[model samples]
Target: MPIIKLSVSERRRLQVFITCLLLAMAAWVLTTLSGAYHFTIKQVINFKNAPQRRAFKALQSDSVEVTMLGTGWQMLFSKVNTYNTPITVDLHTLEHSNYIALNTQIAQLNKTTDAKHRIVAFTPDTLYFDFTNRVVKKVKVEPVLDIKYQQQYEESGKIQVKPSYITINGPGNVIQNIKTWKTDTLRLTNVNDVVSTTLPLQPAKEGNISIYPKSVQLRIPVEEFTEKTLRIPVKLINNPHYYNVKVIPQYVSITFTVPLSRYTEVDEDFFEATADFSLWEQGYSVLPVNITRIPAYCRIVKTAPRNVDFLVRK
Candidate 1:
């Protein structure tokens, strides 16, 4: 076949048509990519929002660090923990900067996906921590003795106790500079029997940790006693009707032994000690005599020697 020669005008028209087709194809490819491809981002992560609940004790910050990681789309910006949650670091667990960096990286991975967002940035590759030894402090002693006793019983002796205070051990930062510890308010009324107990100690300031000894032992001495006396009542038996009865001695002396504390309650000496002779008639008779109505601790050892003679006449 023979080649045909093209004019300038025709060549220009063909070039314009081809250029337009190429432009349309490029636009179609771009649109397809925008709808089909899903990309992730990185964002900042807040260490504070990590914890869900309030930890009982204060945490150390020296060894802790925060880092955020996410899908390429998610890591685009910094991430914040919820408004109420607080993030804390354990000083004891912090050995080096790697500890802080490791924790931060873990926090980043916590996001929905492994991809890091574009807006997030991790800096200060490492963290520093400081530490010191823990210590114990002295606290005041509390007494828990009951002073109220039962009826007719009283405390008549002295009270004594051993070491009144104890020591507590805890973290140096928390224990240092503390002068003393004290127990809560205590009151005991109307206690008479032996009373002994221990009391718990509380820290004056927050964040102070203590362990080992929570309370101290307490001791109290008590006793019961009665008073002594020397007053005895008289008893009378056998009396004669026919003849006048003659007794050698009218009254007999008496004494008793009791606790000194109760000496005042037992001191009266007026009792009748007569023997009835109505049972026998016409002849002399003998009767037995005894003592009654004495204190709980008192005893009668002896009585004076005396005799009563009974006579009967027509």
Candidate 2:
């Protein structure tokens, strides 16, 4: 192959082009390395689950300062990009944990990457995070329990569950000196047969403690189906003294569906079934007879609403 050669003028032109390109590249490098622009170094603190997070009672330092090295473009975009969000380490989690310099964790935040992809680095070679023991406020723990009542019995009966307290896990200062959690009064009224329910646990008024399990299991003892009948005493209200009127029916049949535990509370003699004659004077042709004063745990299965009709002639 024949050798190729360049003329003098062509060579000179090529030299000038190379010189201009190198000078332009040098200027760009100097612009970045001048370090005239001010940059911010923000300490990053990361925390998960912001919604359910517990607030810190105290921290050694709220803010930290670091020297940043980067171009103007990198500094502006750094604000939008998160280096880290504040973290609240439960003091309890730190129990039996020592020789751990908190500053090491803070240093991780300083090396945070910039959003603008600038070749920037942080100064001081490390970050400082000062965390002090905080005074935390106490939160109440609410427990929920499920219960099933005995058969053939209404739910109006009272129940007792031993050791109704629960343990709460949280910051050390919060759970360290805590004990006992209570449940609210369970209200099951006039419910016959086996019943199942979840009871909410209530916490004592004191230090802040959050219960791990919001609900608890409640199993109520139930008795099999049983039938009982009693003769209830009848009482009358607003009897007319002017007219000789008698309560045609003196006794009413009282039946109840109750658990064996509550059977003793029922008193048939206490119940009074009566039709007020004054209602007739008030232009009432017929009075709707109803049973009053039934056992709290008992239900009226068969009630004699119109057991008897009285004939009164004045």
Candidate 3:
């Protein structure tokens, strides 16, 4: 590296130029700090000491315009950060009307600002608030599901909800009409197995409400089902004492599809097939075999020999 050394006369001239620039900068700074400047800032209002089982809703906006007189340096810093510290309005200090005139409270804000700056004026000098009685209630959670299963797979049992319910707190007028909270729509395709997940609850479109425990878990049971067939005997029912009728067919085949869990529980004895003689008519000689009972879980796929001929002996 090559260094270029300056002569004494040249260095003295450079030093004088630097000194004059520093002096001018200091003079400008002092002059700017001496004058007062006006600025508009946003001061958020916080509600504290609210009554139990009560919510405070300010009828107006939560922010206020606070015009203050301050030096240019103070205004510059404040403008850089227009968000001032929040001021508290204690509900315990309000009147029966549930209103607080903030005109008296501005003095408290001035104290929190920079000591060199003066808060000359502000708008909304006063604000109105509505204190509503908070009502808490538990409502059922509804799942919105759109699911498609793959071949040979289907839902086995009812969809189970973990929480089942949610607690909501809001104004009485709004909470009174809330019957249930529904979750957002869930879409799934080719679901071959169980779907266990947590879904977030959607806010009610109509009211201003707050829900606790925002999300709930859903356990969707799934299984594969195979076709099952059973043979059931046809018996005579509601027969008159004078007439004894015997069905031409002694047994009928009942084919159904049962879930694997209930495969052993469903059988011939689990169902009832009977031909009611009372239902017999003169021209209608065909005895209709009525399926009086079947397992609740199994779906009946088919029944053979729906009707049979009967020989009556009196």
Total clashes in model 2, counting residue pairs 3 or more apart in sequence or in different chains:
19
Off by over 4 Å in 1: 1-91, 94-133, 137-163, 170-179, 222-314
Q: How many pairs of residues collide in each model?
A: 53, 19, 0
Tell me the TM-score of each prediction against the true structure.
0.29, 0.39, 0.51
Question: For candidate 2, lDDT tens digit of each residue in 53-95?
Answer: 3423323333344445556555555578543344332244333
Tens-place lDDT per residue, model 3, 149-197, is 8876777787888799999987787788889889988899998888999
Q: Rank the candidates by TM-score, best first.
A: 3, 2, 1
- Assess the local accuracy of residue 295 in candidate 3 as a C-alpha lDDT between 0 and 100: 67
lDDT of 2 at 55: 25
lDDT of 2 at 110: 37
Q: Write the per-residue lDDT of candidate 1 for residues 37-64, one digit (tens) a residue.
A: 2232222223332111221233333222
* Candidate 1 colliding pairs, count: 53
Q: Judge candidate 3 against the unseen true structure and give its global Cα lDDT, from 0 to 1.
A: 0.79
